[model samples]
Target: MKSMKYFLLVLLTLMGAHYVEARPVTLVTLGNSLTAGDGDDGIGGGYPTRLVSKLQTANPGSVLLQFGISGDTTTDLINKQLTPAVAALNAAPSANRKIALVWIGSNDFFGFYNYTITEAWCSGMGLEACENSEFGASADNASTILAALQATGAALYIALLDDQSKRPVITEPALRAATFPNISDEYAARMATHLSAYNSRVQAHADTYGAQTVDFFNTTIFEAPATLSDDGNHPSGAGYDAITDIWHNAVTGSSPSSSSIVPNSH
Candidate 1:
């Protein structure tokens, strides 16, 4: 009788352990308007939200907590949010935590706009403006955020900013005619120069902190059809879906297996 009781106790303990191990993971997303799901026709369905939906279907029970605000620069995240949130999560009792997705820096680039210029000078036109945007994240600031997050011991996924030059707000014919009738490709190239610098900084920080970098910069949504969004910039629902596919693959460590998961035509 004594041996049977001991055997039963051991079996019950093993079952409990298995149950605990099967629990879903908890994730957090931190960033700005893009993270907040801005241009998705008010669905609040930005890439992060799309990502959450994908993860839930792929791995049931995974929960995503969002801490994003519109127009938030990288500096804002580090100063106003990241530290406290990290502290709170660290204090939580849950052991099945997985990843933190960070997507910031668009505002930093957009905030560079000062006045209309020919495309010929678009690249340099924003240089002075970019340097002056107080909210912009210097390379050092990005590194700091990465290091702080790393200290919390969570897996990190960092996204690079999309090319801002493609946004309709900057490229629309009507807006361009009204704003700067003589826009030149040079102006666009100059803007690209500054954007490249900022993106490189972000990539360097991710590399330094050992975080995986999502290559949103060169994706088809931005490069092909270039008309990804009606607005010319923020990804349409379809655009966000493409981003979702990229992130899903990054997290799952496997290529997306079906077209059902791919973003529908825009």
Candidate 2:
């Protein structure tokens, strides 16, 4: 009788362990240049990488995947990447896998040259320009991409575009001379207006999809001219690190190393 009781206890413990292990959550990031870390040496060490590192440190068992690429528009992702990736994730053995991060739309705004003639010059020089000239999902075709991702039952986190006016590259005299004959305060304000509409659309989509939104728009670091890199657009390594912290807080509901508990979505 004593032996039987010990055997049953061990069996139950093993079963519990198996149960917990069966439901692994998989996090995936989808986006364009910013998501791909284009301006940051092309190693893909952008915010997604940092976000994954932080999450893994916090939750040892969670799996993270990045599917971001340089110069991919929302239309491109929806047509080329999103479906295939999600299908594969669904087929995986872990029934509890979930997507957790998605940041896009900077390219959409930047492509349009909304702020100044510099963007136009860059496009003229064969650099990637914002394709969404019309503004919002209508412009970038984000609506379909967002909807499909949400349909997969993955919990999502969406980040707003960083303030473009604060980018250092835009103000660089040399780059300015190369890209635009004249970049004025009026041009900057006009660009902001267009980009703001895009950000608003992103937020609206997030709400529609039940995704949590992170507002980089109002963040001091993202809006500070000095925090950007030489190009004046992409975040420096330090800036990316700060963004990682913000994402960590938004998703996990606690700062790094804090005792705050993240609730399971199940």
Candidate 3:
């Protein structure tokens, strides 16, 4: 069967007087603020840019298209970015290799718990019930997106949620005690557990689709003061650089850099 396919290709080449050429790999990203590069200096100012810098050094003509939005949820990715990401993959030749990134779910949790979300919903659903529902929905959407892209024969690199309880948005111990004193560290701990479950969902989806899962659960940049920007939620330049290293290690299957050591996606 292999020989037959090669013979047909040769015959077609002779008839058309044309030669087959390889296409550079395309990297399409779909996620939230991290993928959109929200907390970075500007649009295209996040890890993707650093990733491009790394990829370009080897694959000069490689294409990088990021479809991240600052506050996108898993549903937002499905409703908004999924179609475009598939379109981008389809535009390339069938034989070309492709890579995509799907790092989301933080906002699903954040959106549910934000001050503007109102307590009525939580009181009705119960806090644990709400968390479980979000977790299930996030996993389902991630699976749908991964299956569609996998059908195009592209390699995918899905990321797990970072430990957001450490982010400034949730940390300020004193302020947290004053603001939501009833549930300060307790809330953070609950979020950490939920995110871990979400990461497991992402990993299961990746395994089902022959994709790679990138890790961010144990990264210290978010926990440390140096890597965070003034907003505290968004990563500083140094933080992005550290994230780039993490991504580089993930995509290339290398050991983590000096910035981090959390390796296994599982």
Candidate 4:
């Protein structure tokens, strides 16, 4: 009977371990106003909340935490958002899945544009040089955030910023230059080019860190009035659902694009 008693104790220990392993995952979203569900229906809980619900259907007990501060840039993410997310992810039980979804840089571009044009800040750097510098800094800051997220061993997905040029705020001449006063079409086009380059850098980072990319830059919801809010920037409730559908596809391994998941560079 001594042998039987020992076996029971071992089985009980194993069962306890299994119970811990069966706990829910945590999905952390790092983004800006849109990710916060700024313009969505009801009380402004948008895609992230819907995404949490969707994930719960598959990962029953899974929970979500959104750190999407409006006007947050890549620098803000590095200086403010990264530390807490990394800590939470690392502190969670090792068996639980730690996942992160990052989408930022909206204010970074605006900030860069304004800073570059300011006579005092620009001095004699020349507009092209100033823009390039801002672009590079944004990319570098984003890389830093991604590295921190990767360090926590979380499954990472970094979204490429959408084409602001398509947004109503940018297209309408009066509203377009609201942030970057007197911004010309030609100059805005250059900004879009810089944004594209930024996205390329984002994909490169994902390749380095075994993460994924969601190509909102190439996504079609921009001009679709139904997908965008009345203001033409943040997504509507239906837009959130559409965004979540795309995210769900990526999470389920059927990535929207063939190159969505970056291959790790050993």
In terms of lDDT, which candidate is strongest? 4
lDDT for 99 (candidate 2): 60
Q: What is the lDDT of residue 17 in candidate 3?
A: 33
Descending-TM-score candidate ranking: 4, 3, 2, 1
Across 1-266, the per-residue lDDT of candidate 4 in tens digits comes to: 99985675577467542212223567888878877787787435777787767666555777887887887888877777788888878787755677888988877776665565766666578878877787788877777888888888888888888877677767776666564565678767877888899888888887888778887887867667888777766788878878887776665454433322212212
lDDT-best of 2 and 4: 4
lDDT of each: 0.64, 0.63, 0.72, 0.73
RMSD of 2: 8.0
Residue-level lDDT of model 3, residues 49-158, one tens digit each, is 78866765544566788888888988899889989989998887554457777788877876665541357776688778877876788787888989888876676788
Between candidates 2 and 3, name the one with more favorable TM-score: 3
Model 3 alpha-carbon drift over 4 Å, by segment: 1-23, 42-44, 115-121, 173-184, 255-266
Q: Write the per-residue lDDT of candidate 2 for residues 108-199, one digit (tens) a residue.
A: 55545534235555456452233333464543455566677777777777777766655554556565555543545565556677677777
Q: In model 4, what lDDT does residue 231 have?
A: 72
Which of 2 and 4 is the better model by TM-score? 4
Q: Any residue pairs clashing in model 2, and if so which?
A: 111-129, 111-130, 167-232, 168-232, 169-231, 169-232
> What TM-score would you give candidate 1 relative to the actual structure?
0.72
- Model 2 is weakest, by summed lDDT over 10 consecutive residues, at 15-24
Global lDDT of model 4: 0.73
What TM-score quantifies how close candidate 3 is to the native fold? 0.79
